[model samples]
Target: MMRSILERASHWLALVCRVIAGVALIAMLGVTIVDVATRYLDRLSDGAVAVTLLGSVELVSYLMLCSLLAAMAANVEKSQVVVEAFSHGLSPGFKHRLQGVYLLGFAALGLILCLGLVDSAAAAARHGEVTQDLRLPMGPIYTTAAVLSLLLGVRALIHALLGALFGAEGEVSHGE
Candidate 1:
């Protein structure tokens, strides 16, 4: 029962990430449009257009990075990376053991990244950093991204372990 719930949750989370990615793409498009409009307005006004364009650039760049992260996380969940060399002539047991090792290493790396990002974000927040023009606070975004990355990394490790233990290559569905 718990396994089923985890599987379902993973699927739902992937779907949500896909949706957010799509929305972020749309927002980036909108930002481009706004930048264009502001350029035209700049010809009439003194320099208000420059400010708006800069703000849009900053906001859109950050959003697009977030979207890319979402999509990349989904790819990791799907096990979409190529592992061609390891595919040849390995026994089932060996393959499973190798996968387990890879997952544990990856989990450790992800934990380190999560900790570093959290520390960086906290330091930035303490300094009261703000983006130019928009003056947007980046603390929340940094923290959220770090947390999500951590969660996704942990999930990936768990799924990899589960598959290595009880699942065959064809039997496990990695949110495909």
Candidate 2:
């Protein structure tokens, strides 16, 4: 029962992350289009109607970061790149073990990255770092990124455990 509940929660979390990523992507596209249109209008009007959105670059950068970070969990869960070239001839059990080891390694790497991000975020907060154009605080953004990284590490670790216990073939399914 507990495992079932945890699985459900994981599914919902992955879904939410994917949804957030999609929203961020759409927002970034809209902002970029508006910024470009404003630039074009400014040129046509000979600077008479200056309408460029301030801090657009900063906004876009934040949106890109959000999109990338938000999508990471879903990507790790569902979009793992498969390369059959190297393991084509391996037996199923061997392949599963290999994949389990690889996933554990990936989880370790993610943990390291998460730690680095945490340190970076603390430094940014201490230094009062902010975006140049918008003066947006960099600390919160870095902290959020660190949270996402931590989530990715947890997800990868879960996947590794599943693979190890049940074989890669018995790992979590997409269900679609």
Cα TM-score per model: 0.74, 0.84
Clash pairs, model 1 backbone: none
- At residue 19, candidate 2 shows an lDDT of 88
Worst 10 residues of 2 by lDDT: 167-176
Q: Candidate 1: TM-score?
A: 0.74
lDDT of each residue in 56-116, candidate 2, tens digit only: 9889998898888778865665545557898788777666666666677767876887898
Pairs of residues clashing in candidate 2 = none
Query: 44-158, model 1: which lDDT tens digit per residue?
Result: 7877556456678788877887787666555444554537585567766566556655666656765777788798789879998777768877787788677657755765666
